[model samples]
Target chain A: MSEHKNHISTYKSQILVLLTLIMLTVLTVVITSVHLGPFNTAAAMLIASVKAAIVLLYFMHLKFDEKIYRFMVTLVLAIYAVVIIITFFDYLYR
Target chain B: MTGNTSTHRLPSYLEYQGKYTGILGWILSTDHKRIALLYLYSQLFFFLAGLVMGIFMKLELIAPGQQIMGPQAYNALFTVHGLTMIFLFIIPGLAASFGNFMIPIMIGAKDVAFPKLNLFSWYLFIAGAVIILIGIFSGDGPPDTGWTFYAPYSLKTNTNVVLSVFGAFVLGFSSILTGLNFIVTIHRMRAPGMGFFRMPLFIWSLYGTAWIQLLATPVVGITFLMVVADRMLDIGFFDPAKGGDPVLYQHLFWIYSHPAVYIMILPAMGAITEIIVTFSRRTVFGYKAIAMSSLAIAFVGYLVWGHHMFTSGMSETARLVFSFLTFLVAIPSAIKVFNWTATMYKGSISLEPPFWWAMAFIFIFMIGGLTGLILGSVSTDVHVHDTVFVVAHFHYIVFGGAGIAFFAALHYWYPKMFGKMYSKKIANWGLIGLFVGFNTTYMPMFFLGFMGMPRRYYDYLPQFADLNLLSTVGSWIMAASLIVVIVNLLRARKGTPEEMDDPWGGRTLEWKIESPPSLENFEEIPVIDSEPYELKSK
Candidate 1:
């Protein structure tokens, strides 16, 4: 418990991550405005995923956390990915 | 054990003053235990309300042609029935009441992470409950939009759809906060040496359930908000007029709802795990497997929500994928079922009331899950979709799974909670009546459903009359059985007292304390030096 305090990331890395997230969100909104045909929704979601990664890694502090915490986050994301992919497949095939 | 000194300093609530005795103290007090009692009383009220609605619904179908009520009234009856049972009865009945009382004690903590938030959650639950009841009485009409509150119909309906859906939205917020509190408490507040695996199975199950509640609840929150927006403001998320897809609504609803079933069952499963090992007088066969299966079920449960939409014109490939995933989810459930059964084999088994409920849970849930596989098959589900079969399948799991498990836990923990033992003889009679009445009530519905009796209908074809008559009779019997169980428990509060701690020779830390324990739970936090359910000391 004592070691965890010193191991916490400094202020600079936090600022960098926040900046990156803002840039990604702006890029997503811009992409949505442009008519990319069927690719618009996909492009928006991909950018949103990038933003989510920054939040998970920095704001939630998963980057500097133990391996088990990383495993838990990855496991939940994998399940979500499977459900989304399967539902999309159903939509496409029908 | 110094009896005189102990009685002189009995916990504040237990001091038997004549002024505020019996039910008054239970309903009016701020003690967590008494508040839990309040939740128990209110939940029973709604359970009986739902049960009466169910009886009337079956009665109406006895010979069709609006036998008991008009079509509009019938619609209101079934709509309120589903809403009351799901939101008001089963969801909060087991988890909120029992979880609030036991989680703090189980994990060697004084109270939940946020004690005021705990009380706030209960008040919010009661507020939602009151709104639903007001909808029932106002005669502006109860919500006939079904518990799902599917749109287009929801937007146009003159029923109390807005009030009921708003109630559900409020209930979701309450559930989310409870889950958040449990998550933080479990992670941060375990006693000095109670490691991850060292915690009781009930705690692990609550840990898993809290995650489901946190993750899945937000989706439903967003879905309900969208429904309100569409109905009140004509926002176009689910309106086909605005090019919004209605099927997308089903997707979002089931994504939360399927995991919501796990949310209902997981804590009950945790309760059963504890009951099984304690009564069998043996270690659980696969402790880690049972724990991990809970996590597996929670994870796999989210992916299979699509199976609910199989006949809703989903693509063939999507149907096939959901079908496979649904079967995959059942595997973890099967693993849990087998592990519980194996724990009983070659071990000293006691036929206590809790164990009886546990055994019944296994029997009925197996039937429910197996029939679910049939529904998971794309072709068969198309045949039975929206029929009485679907209703019967769901009731079997919800009633037989969570409902039965609730009874088992109540019986298992009654001594610890009240410091007195119930009459096992009467409880046994209650169990038999419940089993007989339950099967009689639900079994005929499957046949009627296959014969094309649509659910949520006030009137039905004359051909299905006899089965409806049988089901109504069965419901009456079930109601009678429930009354008997409640009376027996109430009577137990005055009977002969038992030895204070570990009445059942239980292994968990909870039984290590005095019955109806001190408010802070343990006088000293216990260090875990061995796995749970290890009967023979090493």
Candidate 2:
């Protein structure tokens, strides 16, 4: 177990990430009031995914980690996206 | 003894006393080898229980009317049999038992990245098994939805679906933790000079399996929770009255269950690869291809889950796409089979017990895999969807693939694990009986299924009687053979060890150490210089 220099995030960056998350949450609620039929679920999911990525990158310290960690995150998200799309093949066609 | 400077032989993992003694030394210890034995014992016990349930079910299907059990009893029997075999035995069978024992040593590491977490996973495994058993014996009745736990029926069944689903949820957690432990261990624990490609093929297969365990298991775990929520709170996740789609539930279930099959078989494939290379006295052909193909199988396996849902009312487009993906997976799987075959080409082949078991695995698994393509096709699958053909295909794949490989790995590693050699002549008899009896039991089912016999039924048509009777007789032979195999291994437990350490001239790191390895596997981890399984003559 070798000790290395740690990347400490500035309060400004943390506060900015927090505010963006809050703004996205409000926008999610605001968008639900205006119905876009099928696009409503799509819109909300897109925003939620963005929020998740933000939390993963900043809150989870993945931003300061090795490149392999980021690659793994992308791989997991890719798998999840593929599952949802395959599932929607049934729903969209039906 | 080779790398270590210590003169006197320290205690082998079997006799090493920890914080506590006796059974406590086993159950409470964090050692990976001891934990593997714990899983082996528990798996053996549950496997016997499942085997008994299967025998009773086969007996019920023998003539036409109920032999000794009623319709409802037969339903419960098949349900519990699938549950016990799938969850408690085969799913964790090879990976938990042999993977735990071999992975760290094969990679030249002392222990897994998280030793305590490994022990905790075993405890969770037992807890989950206990909860499932309670759900069986103490409920309103055993779950009759079968192992797939298809929705709508599962939602309304009075037979304790909630408890069983919850128990499965817990078991999924254990799988996830063990998978996590292996991933971290393999990533961080390989000895110096060992690159990713230099590691043994068994480690590669475990790596692929661990990913499936970590990523795919949680999907089913959440799905099981939703089933429980539907029963307890009327949430209607799959309830038709509440506008929840039953097909959605099928989608969710197979999303995990399909990849779960890979979880069962990949480690088995890895074990077979080792046995094939060792007995052939040759280097594995297409080493990089075999390693990459494992990852390919894992990745593609996740996409083809919808093949299980084709007749379950999924859309035509989804079925078509899923069928294509299913065929794609066959490519990588075929790569492995060809590689194993090529490894044995013109080499100094040793007809050992483990090699015979590996041979049986290939032959049986090929039948299973090819029959699987028949089911993977949308048109043919629609015909044999719920028929005995599907059941036969499943048993061939899961039982023949993973089950046979488990025995292969046990025979290959037994001398190292327990420092005792099982009877060669008896082992040969057991394999013949198993192969002959297995084919007799399942081969007729394929014909019976093609002739239109539905599975999970207590009674059948008068015309179906002869084949069903033949299948039942085969089950009796298989059961007797299984007894012979287990008793032979058990008798070896008290026998003397061989003087040599590298009994099979194995090329892996585990073969380089003492038979029945020390407390921490290596005194000082040996540095690697060549590819794993590099034959000296070659």
Best by lDDT: 2
Q: Write the per-residue lDDT of candidate 1 for residues B1-538, one digit (tens) a residue.
A: 1011133224623543434667665544545655666677778888888888887777777676867788888877778888998988887756787887788777777777887677777788889888877776775667878888876788789887777877888888888988888888888887766788878888888888988888888888888888888878888898778988788888888989899999989888889989999889988888889999998988888888988998777888888888888899888898888999899899899878888888888898888888898899888999999999999999889998898988899999988887889999999999999999999899999999999888888877879888888888888888889889989998998887776557787887777677877656665565566666667532
Given candidate 2, what's the lDDT at residue B304?
Answer: 95
Q: Model 1 TM-score?
A: 0.92
Poorest stretch of ten by lDDT in candidate 1 chain A = A1-10
Q: What DockQ does each prediction reach against the true complex? A: 0.69, 0.83
Give residue A80's lDDT in candidate 2 (0 to 100). Answer: 88
Query: Would you give me the overall lDDT of model 1?
Result: 0.81
Q: How would the docking of model 1 be graded?
A: medium
What's the TM-score of chain A alone for every prediction?
0.82, 0.90
DockQ of 1: 0.69
lDDT of 2 by residue, B1-538 (tens): 1353435566899989878999899989999999999999999999999999999989888899879899889888898999999999999979999999999999999999999999999999999998998998886978989999999899988997888888899999999999999999999999987899999999999999999999999999999999998988999989878978999999999999999999999999999999999999988999999999999999999999998888888888999999999999999999999999999998899999999999999999999999999999999999999999999999999998999999989999999898889998999899999998899999999999999999989999999999999999999999999999999999999887775467888999888778798989888887777777877622
Which runs in model 2 stand beyond 4 Å of their true positions? A1-3, B1-8
Here, model 2's chain A TM-score works out at 0.90
Whole-model lDDT per candidate = 0.81, 0.92
Give candidate 1 regions above 4 Å deviation: A3-26, A33-35, A55-83, B1-32
